[model samples]
Target: MEAVAKLNNYPTSPRKMRLLADMIRGMEVEKALAQLEHNPKHPAVPLRKLVVSAISNWKQKNEGGDESTLIVKTIFVDGARTIKRMRPAPQGRGYRVRKRSNHVTVIVDTK
Candidate 1:
């Protein structure tokens, strides 16, 4: 059985979030949370929270289950809506700036 958690419209680029997601994929749940907690990355904070939430969700779904055997089975980040803004440039020109967002899905399962 697997437990899944999703975070949508996260205000970070998919490329940046993928770096952290790749590290936790296939790792033990406890170890993954620890890594995210210690890592000095903006996205890691929310990722850790999502993992904790997933753990609780698993517990609620499966009564009398052991959490120690849980592992981060799959995690992925995908591009989401982009916010576009205009930045003032030299010579009275405007430059388009794209603020990217992403959605992340994490699935934890018993090993």
Candidate 2:
């Protein structure tokens, strides 16, 4: 059995989030949480929250499920949108700025 959780509109770029997600893929739930907790990257906070949400989903779906048996089967991050803005530059020129966002999904399943 598997359970999935998603974090939408996260204020980080997809490329950055994917790097953190890759580290925890196929890892046990507990270990993944620990790794995320200690990670120095700012993206770790959202990833940690996402993992916890996945665990909660697993528990809710399986009333008698043992958490110790669960593992992070897969994790993915995808680009959502880039909010475009204009910033004033030197010489009366305007520069385009893109603020990126991402969507993250994590799946957990029992061993």
Q: Which number leads on TM-score?
A: 1
Position 68, candidate 1: lDDT? 98
In terms of lDDT, the poorest run of 10 residues in model 2 is 63-72
Q: In the order shown, what is each candidate's alpha-carbon RMSD?
A: 0.6, 0.8
Clashing pairs in 1: none
What would the TM-score be for candidate 2 when compared with the true structure? 0.96
Give model 2's clash tally.
Answer: 0
Q: List TM-score per model, in order.
A: 0.98, 0.96
> Model 1, stretches more than 4 Å misplaced?
none
* lDDT of each residue in 1-111, candidate 1, tens digit only: 788899999999999999999999999999999999999989999999999988988998899999999999989999999999999999999999999999999999999
Off by over 4 Å in 2: none
The best candidate in terms of lDDT: 1
lDDT of 2 by residue, 1-101 (tens): 79999999999889999999999999999999999999999999989999999999999999987899889998999899889999999999999999999
lDDT of each model, Cα atoms only? 0.95, 0.93
